[model samples]
Target: MMEKIWQRKTDETIGKPILEVFPELLDQKYPELLNDVLSKGITIRENESIAYIQQKEKLEKFYLDYQYTPLFEKNGTVNGIMITVYDVTNKVEARKKVEVAEQRTRLAIEIAEIATWDLDFLTDNIIYSENLPQIFGQEKGSVITRQKIKRQIHKDDLPVLKKAFGLALQTGIYKYECRIIKPDAEVCWIRVHGKLFFDENKNITKMLGTVLDITDEKNSHQTLMKSEEKFRLLADSMPQHIWTSDPLGNLNYFNKSVYKYTGLFIDDLKEQGWIQIVHPDDQKENINSWMEAVKTGNDFLFEHRFRRYDGEYRWQLSLAIAQKDEYGNIQMWVGTSTDIQDQKNFTDKLEREVSERTAQLELKNRDLINMNIELQSFAYISSHDLQEPLRKIQTFASRLSDLDEQNISAKAKTYLGRIEVSAKRMQTLIQDLLTYSRTNSAERVFVKANLDEIAEEVHSDFYERIEEKKLLSIFTL
Candidate 1:
C-alpha cells in the first residue's frame, strides 16, 4: 500500500496540465491521457505503468490501473478532467519470476535429452513436448498421435509397451525399456518412466512420463558381454589343460581339456578341488610353489605327475603366468599342464643303455692290452732258442771238413759242403728273427745308419764262403 501512493516530490506540480507536470511521460507511454482526455474533453481508462526517479537518487518503477473521468458544468459539454492511478508493481515482478523459471526448466530438459509426454487415458490422446518429434527423428513441433508413436516403436517391442501400459491402471506406475525406429528409420533404445494420476474416485485420469536416450550405455554393455563369450570359447578349444583363477589363486574356470583329462566335471573343480588330480607325492610341493607365485606375481614352473582319466599317472610340465591389467594389478592367474611323459621315458632309457655299453667296452680294452704283452715275450724267446741249435751244426760241419781231405772220397766232400751251407743259412734266419723281436718289444729310436758300413759287415761275415765258391766280388759301394 505504501508503494501505491504517488510521492509529492515526484508530482510537485500535479495540479498543472499533464504534459507540463510530467514531461518525461511522452505521448507514447501515456498516450490517451495526454491526447484523448486533454484535447477531446472525454473519459479515458487504461492499465499501464511508468517509471519515475524520486528524491533519493533511486529508480522507482510502477504499474498502475488508472482512469480519467470527465467533469462538466450544468450544460451537456465537458469542461474539466479527473485522473487516478493505482500501483501494481508486485504483481508484475512475481509474474516475471515465474516466466524466467519456466524458461530454465525448458533448457534443462533439452540438455538432459529428456522427452516428456502427458497421456489422457479418457480420450486416448497423448500430448508431447515441443522437442518430442525431433527426438523421434521428425521436424520439431510436428503433430503426433498415440497410434503414430506406437508405429514408431520397433515391431518386436510393441507388445512389451502394450503390456506395461495395460497394467498401469491398477499399478499407478510403469517403467520399461524398448527399441524404437525413428521417422528416418534409424533404431535407438529408450527408457520410459511414468506414474498415473488418479481422480478422487480412485480412477486413472492421466499419465506423465519422461524418455531418455540410452543407446550408448546399451551398446557398451553388449560389447562387453560379447568379449567375455569369445574368450571362453577360445579357452575351451585348446588341447592343453588350461585353467584360470582369481588373483588370490582361487580357481574359477577350467578348459574342456581339464575335464576330459581328469575325469571331473566343472562343479567338482571349484576352488582348490583341482589339487585332487595331482599325484600324492607332488601335491604339497605343487600347492606351495603356486601360492608363492601368486603372492609375488611371478611366473611359475614345475614338473609333476598327474593322474589321467584311465587311472594312470603321467608326467606333466605345469606353467603359470599372472595376467595383469594396465595398472599392473594382477587380475587373474592363467596356467597350463602339457603332457611330457613320452619324452621323459625316452631320455631315461637312453641314459641306461649308454652306461651299460661303456662298461662292456672298458673290459674288452683291458683284455687286448694283456694279449699284446704275451705275444711280444714269445717272439723274443723263440729267436734266442733257434740260434743255439744252428751254431752247434756249423761247429760239427767245420770239424769234419778239417779231417784229412786225402782220405775222403769226392762224394763225401760234396755232402760236407752242403751241410756247412745249410748251417750258415739257419744262422741268417735266426738273426732276422731276433731283429723282428726287437722291433716289437723295444721302443725304436730312429738313427741315420751308413749303407756302406752295413754292406761291409755282411761281406766280412761271408768272406770264406764267397772265396770257396768263387762267387762274384762283393762291392762296398
Candidate 2:
C-alpha cells in the first residue's frame, strides 16, 4: 500500500506523510493529542503519508490513505511531513459508559446495605455481590461455597428454608423470610427474597436473591407480643370483676369475680343473655346504645345495674369498644368490667349516714325553736312586770321630789330625785338586755350571702362601740 501511494503521480496524489503535509497538525485540532501523536500516531497508518494539498494555500488538509484523512503542505518546506488520523472515539466512549454503570451499581449496593447473590443451579456455581463482605463479616474474595452458604443459615430453620426454596424453584415464585446465623455466633434474622428461572427442560438455571438484616425488626415484634401477653395474663388474674364482650354486645369472657358475683356459669352468659340481669330501668337504653354502636361500628362505653347472686341489684360500670379492621369494619370488642361493688357499698353507707344526720338536725332545730319561743314569752312577761314596778317607783319618787319643805325635807327630796333617776336607768338596761338575748336562740335559717356586704353591715353596728372605746381596728382579706 505504501509503494503504490509513493509511485502515484504528483498531480494525482502527494506522497508526503500526513505530518509532513500538515506539519502543525499537533498544534491544530486537538493539541492534547500531541503525546498521543508522538507515541501512537505512526503505528495506525505507517504505510501512508501526506500525498496532496487541495487548498490553493498550504492551510488545506487532504486524505492520502483515504478521503477521510486531511493533508496539508507548507509553501517553503523542502521535506514534507505526514500526519496520521486514527479514530478512537467510539471505543473510548463505550468504555466510559461501562465504567459509569459499574460505579453506579457499586454506589447503590453501598447505600442499600444489602448483599446480593447469584447461583447457576446448572453448574452449582455461586457468585456474590460486592456488598457480601459487609454482610458475611469477611473481606472480599473470601472462600464462598454452597456448603458455606448452607452452614450460615440457622440449624433449626434449615429444613424449613430448604422446603420453601425448593417450592419457589419448582413454581417460579419467590421465597422469602429466612433466618440466618452470623459468624460472630449472633442470631440474625434475614429476609431472603429470591426468584428462580428455568430453562425449557424445567430445570432451575439461575437463582438471584437479596439479603437483609432483619434482626432488630423481628426482635422488636417479639418483644411487643410478649409484653402484650404479660399484660393480658395479669389483668385476667385479678379479683375485680372482669369481662369482655363482642362488638355486637355479646359477652365473650369473664373472670372468677363475675361468676362469683352473678352466680352464673361461663355458659350461662353467652350471646345476649347477660342483658337479662340488667336493671329493668336501664336495660332497654343500655341495650339500644350497644346495638347502635355495633351498627355504626363505633366504640361502646356504658354502665348499668346488674342482678347479683343475693337476688339484689348491683351497680357495675362496664366499658367496651369495637376493635376494627383495616377497612373500619367492627371485628370484635374487648374491655374490662371492675366490680365497683365496694364503691356502691361505700356510697350506700354514706347516704344512710347522711339521712340519719339530717333527721337528728331536724329534731335539734325544732327543739331550739321551741325553746326560743318560750324564752321570748318569758322575757316579755318578766320585762312587763319589772317595768310596772319601775314606773310606780319613778312616779312616787318624782312626786316626793316635787314636795314642799314641810312635806319632804331637802335631804329627802334629794334622795327621791336620786331614786327616780336610778329607776329609769335600770329600766333602760333591762330593755336592751331583753333585745340582745332575744336573738340568742331563735329559729336557725341558712341562706347564701355576699360575705363582704355582711361584714360592712356588722362594721356599721359596732361603729359606736368602736368610737366610744377609741380603738383603731384594721380588717383585711
Candidate 3:
C-alpha cells in the first residue's frame, strides 16, 4: 500500500532509511512525530492525517491513518522506530462531499422557512432543525418537545391533529392544516406533511415531517370569502331576480328575490334548473338564447313569460352578461330578470284602444264623405232647377211691366216689382250657396276677387228692398 501510494518500486524503498525513502517527510509533522515516539519509547497513532509528497516531480496530497511505535531491545532502550501506514484519502473525500451537500440542503430549507422534525415515539423525544424554535416564536436554544409543540397548536385544532396522527399510524401518511398560537399570542396557520415509521410489532416508532407557515395564504382566502359574502348580501337586497352561473353555464346561485318570486328552494332550482319556472311556451326560446350566449361567451337578452309564485305567468325582461378575468377568460355569468308584466299589459291595452279609435275615425270619415256627396247633389239641383224657375219669374215680370200702363193697375205693378225682387234675391242666394258647396268639396284654388264687383252684384239683388226701406250706405276707401 505504501509503495502504491508513494508511486515507487519496492526495491527502491524496502531496505532504505525512512528519511532516505520518503525525503518529503523531512519538512512534515511525520518526522517530528516519529522522533518523539522513539525518544519517549511510546506508540502514537493518527487517523486521516493529511500529507503532501513529491511523486514523479509532482506534488500530490494524500490522507492516511498512520502509526509510529518504538522498537525495544532487552536493555529497556528503544533502538529503532517502526512505522505503519494505511491510505484513507478516498473515504475522507467522499465524506467531505456528503457534508457539503447536507449543508446546501439545510440552507435551502432555512430560506424557504421550513422546519424539519423527527419524532421518536420509543423515546418520546423530538429532534428538530435549528429554526424550529423561531417558527414557534420561542427564544433561541429553547428545548422543543412533542408536548410543547402540541401546546402551541390552537385548542380548536387539537382534535384534528390527533386524528391525523391516528390516521398516519394506520396509513403511514400524515397531512393536516391547522392554526397555531405563537408565544406572543399571535395566531398563525401551519401545514404539516409527514411519514410514519413502524417497528416489526406494527407499533409506531418514529415520524418524519416538515412544517410550513401558511398564515398569509389563510388570510387571503378569508378575505375572498368575506368579499363573496358581501356580494351575496347585495344581490339578495335587490328587488330583481338575480342569479349566477359557472363558466360552463351551470346555474349555481340565486338570490333571495329568486326564491321569493319562484317559491322554490335552492336545491330544487339547482337540480331542475331555474328554467323550470319559465312559461312552457317560452321555455324553448329561453333555452336557445341562453345556450347561444354561453357557447359564444356573449351577453344574453330575452323577453319571456315566467311563472310566478302564485301560478300566474308574467312577462319578464331577462338579461345576462359574462364576467371575465384579467386574461379575458370567462369566469362566470351574472344575470337578472325584471318583471315587465305591468308595462306589457299597458302597452297591449294601448294598442287595442288605438285600433278601436282608428276604426271609429275611419267610419266617421266614410259618413262625412257620403254627406259631402249629398251636399254636392243638393247644390247641383239648386243651381239648375231653382234658378230656372227664378229666371222665368223675372222674365214674366219684365214682360208684364213692358205691357201698356193701362192694362196693369198700380197695386198689381207693385206686386210684380216685389215678386221680381224676391225672385232675384232667391237666385243670388242659391248661387252663393252653390259656390260655397263647391269650395268645400273641391281642392281650393285661391283667386283674386274684386270686392267692388261682389258689392255691385249684392246691390242689384236687393235694389228694390233697399229703395223701399231707404237704408243709408257707408264705404271707406
TM-score of each: 0.49, 0.47, 0.62
- TM value for model 1: 0.49
How far is 7's C-alpha from truth in model 3 (Å)?
Answer: 36
Q: Which numbered prediction scores highest in TM-score against the true structure? A: 3
- Candidate 1 segments whose C-alpha is farther than 4 A from its true place: 1-150, 162-175, 191-214, 217-237, 361-477
Candidate 3: where are CA atoms >4 Å away?
A: 1-116, 122-152, 155-160, 166-172, 182-186, 237-239, 260-263, 308-312, 397-432, 439-442, 445-477
Ranking under lDDT, best-scoring first? Answer: 3, 1, 2
Q: Write the per-residue lDDT of candidate 1 for residues 1-477, one digit (tens) a residue.
A: 323343444456546665564455553456445456766777777675655634345546776677888777786567776767667778878887999998898899889989999999899888888877777777876888888878888989988888887887678788888998986778989899999999999888888988888888899989988987887798888888888889999988888988998888877776459888999999999999998999999998999998998999999999999999999999998888899999999989989989998888888888877766675677667767887887788888788888898978777887787778767867777776666655743566677999988687677657768889988865723
Residue pairs of candidate 3 with colliding backbone atoms: none
What is the alpha-carbon lDDT for the whole of candidate 2?
Answer: 0.70
What is the C-alpha lDDT profile of model 3 across 1-477, one tens digit per residue?
645687878898788887998888888998788779878998999899999887888888999999888999999899988778988999999999999999998888888889999999889999998888888898988999988888899999999998998888778999999999998899999999999988899988899999999899899999999999999999999999898899988888889998998888978887888889998999998899999999999999999998878999999998999999999899999999999999999999999999999999999999999999998998888688989888999999999988898999998898888788778888888888788887753666789999988787667666767769987643322
Which stretches in model 2 have alpha-carbon errors above 4 Å? 1-111, 174-179, 240-337, 382-477
lDDT of each: 0.80, 0.70, 0.89
Candidate 1: which pairs clash? none
Model 1 weakest 10-residue run by lDDT = 1-10
Task: Find the candidate with the highest lDDT and give its number.
Answer: 3
